[model samples]
Target: MLLRRGILWLTLCLPLYGETVAGRWHAAVKTPSGEEAYFDLEVNHSGGEWQGMLINGRDRNVSSAGSFDGRKLRLEFNYWDGRLEADFENGELRGAFTRQSRKQVLARPFRARRTPLVSPASAPSVDAGGEWILDVGEGGGKEMWLASFEQDGARLQGVLIPVSGDYGMHTGFVDGNRILLTHFDGIRATILDARISDGRLVGTLKGSVSAMVTGRRPDKAGRQELNSSSLTTMKNPREAFRFSYPDLEGRVVSSTDARFRGKAVVVSISGSWCPNCHDEAVVLRMLYDRYHAKGLEIVALGFEYTGEKERDLRQLRLFAEKYKLPYPVLLAGTTENAQQTLGQLRNFRVYPTTLFIGKDGLVRRIHAGFEGPSTGARYAALQQEMTQWVESLLAE
Candidate 1:
């Protein structure tokens, strides 16, 4: 009887063991490679329920699917397929946190505390302003990356662009001659660190993995810019874009459908696991709302990481429902087999390859990758530029 009473008392005490995790926390994941990523976490507990948000710059990702057993806490992202499982002890939340992407199953050691880390107050030693041409190492797959920075005093804001896509907006600072920048949306986290060495900047982009990258200021004596429009091209530009796929409901949707016959169409080739694609989706929503009634038709070709049709559809449905997308999204295929599945395009490298089609049913322009809101001014300009393209096609 005495032993049973002790066991029952221990169970009862477990419920009261965890302290209230209801405050702003400074959270970070230190990967096995010693690289680190941080994000602002705001948690609230009310009515015996716990919820929170993972904040990265201007994005606030909601975590509503949660459970707290007093000692252990598990919170799932509202839109993405990522979760945080932590134990409350020593006045800190410590556990393994996965990347927000459904394809990302690797969990890293995540720790959070009430206090935030302080940034260095020293002034920058160098001005990291203007466009840079990066020559990535062989391990990264991509040969080049275009990066632009806006620096104000010691603070730095920028976006890293690859041939296929971009690492969303980054917020960081220049410590002496070193540049540090980071971006953590609900989907992924990318940290950049570079140092000036002999009129050149060299660094490594690190997250769950690391890749060496070296860059230099644009030489006016050569190609000053990387044209994203020229990256992915149709094997035969004279032919129109064509595809037939099923949506979440399993109904076939074809490019030849009468609904799109006479309309100026925008085809977004993207994946559910891609963060930059999410950024592009937000802008697509705005453009669809404005020009949808003006003879503009938009469709999304979803290529997911997992080939499982049912699970991919679930994620796609959540993405559409969360954004309240007015257009149809078709599951084309798996991301790994995209090049083979989308046989018409050969140089396909990125998640979000946007193709604009005129009323005549021909692809007018194919813009590879997207500049999301975190890109600041570039994002604003992209909206105007895309709108103008649509307007011109509609006018025809």
Candidate 2:
């Protein structure tokens, strides 16, 4: 009887034992550039000690790990091509944290609920699959812009393919009578917030948000041109201007170089603090190396997170050196908001934006996001199509 009572008492104390900042938590990191990243941290207690692992956020997967020592929390996660440190509030398991290199602030820290992390809704029985046009609305019921959504239900995890834009992985979920789909541009927002009606879902949106996104999910029709416009013509020329910045070796390079004088120059715009940029950078490097001899030169411009130009340069240097980037990388600025950084300089659209600078120095094909090979047959075909574009440009 005494042993049974002791066992019951220990079981009741288990919850109290984990009161020292030692449990799962949901965290979001916001870059000064206005990009929000999501993360799920699993913290475990062993021998009165705590440790953690960060799940997927932005382009980073489950490879992130860290330790919590009462007041000081230290975590290492990959960003761009370098590992970044995240420091938690010394003693508390909650509160705002900063990415060391970029100084991006991650606020609204909260303990993750231990309940099943499922959406509080059901999947509608409609064939929400296939490519459907998306028309976002603003106040007064005005249709703002056009985009696309590809619903695979399983693979590709259902993505929002914006028309002539790019904000990678626009995910959706259905709750009760409402259908909610969202993407991050430094914060989580309801890109689509329509409730289920007769057959479809309808809702309002935040307009300024979509203007910054330029991602697209290619249709699986086997390298077919969905849009007839050549990737080398500047549809928005006046808004786009050309500039130059120095690479790590003090080499001053610009979008107006003779090497890219008459060729299609691809300006790869991304931040060194971005995980998605890592994959995009590798692929861009491969494409640049494979096609440079054939009138193809990629100028990678990094919009890093440091508050100072020198720090931004250093971060960019680290990324370039680590990735062995053969292409020239210029430092844009340390600002986190893309609009403030590029909106004033040029008509910059999105991160990981590939601006195809034509022979006339005019912006041409602007491809957004890198749908890696693992994304399946569509990605493979997309790769082939892009390669074909390069081949055509080379022939020109």
Best by lDDT: 1
lDDT of 2 by residue, 1-396 (tens): 999999999865544444545566555444333433444556665675445555432322332445554344554443322222343443334444334444754442333334323353555544344443444544563322333344444211244433233344445555555544444322232244455455454555442244222222234533323231332234356544466777767788776567767887777777776544665677778788898887788778787775576667777877786678888888766546656645523444445666666666666466655554323454566667677766766665
Candidate 1 residue-wise lDDT, 80-114, digit = tens:
66788888876788997775343556677778888
Candidate 2: Cα lDDT at 267: 78
Q: After superposition, how far is residue 372 of candidate 1 from its true place, in Å?
A: 0.7
| Clashing residue pairs for model 1 | none
Evaluated at residue 85, the lDDT of candidate 1 is 87
lDDT of 1 at 60: 69
**For all candidates, what are the clash counts?**
0, 16
Q: Superpose all Cα atoms of candidate 1 onto the true structure and report the RMSD in Å to 1 decimal.
A: 5.0
> In model 1, what is the error at residue 157, expressed in angstroms?
4.5
Query: Would you estimate the TM-scores of all the predictions?
Result: 0.86, 0.62
**Candidate 1 ranges with C-alpha deviation above 4 Å:** 1-19, 46-49, 99-104, 117-124, 128-132, 138-142, 148-157, 197-199, 218-225
Residue 191, candidate 1: C-alpha displacement in angstroms: 2.2
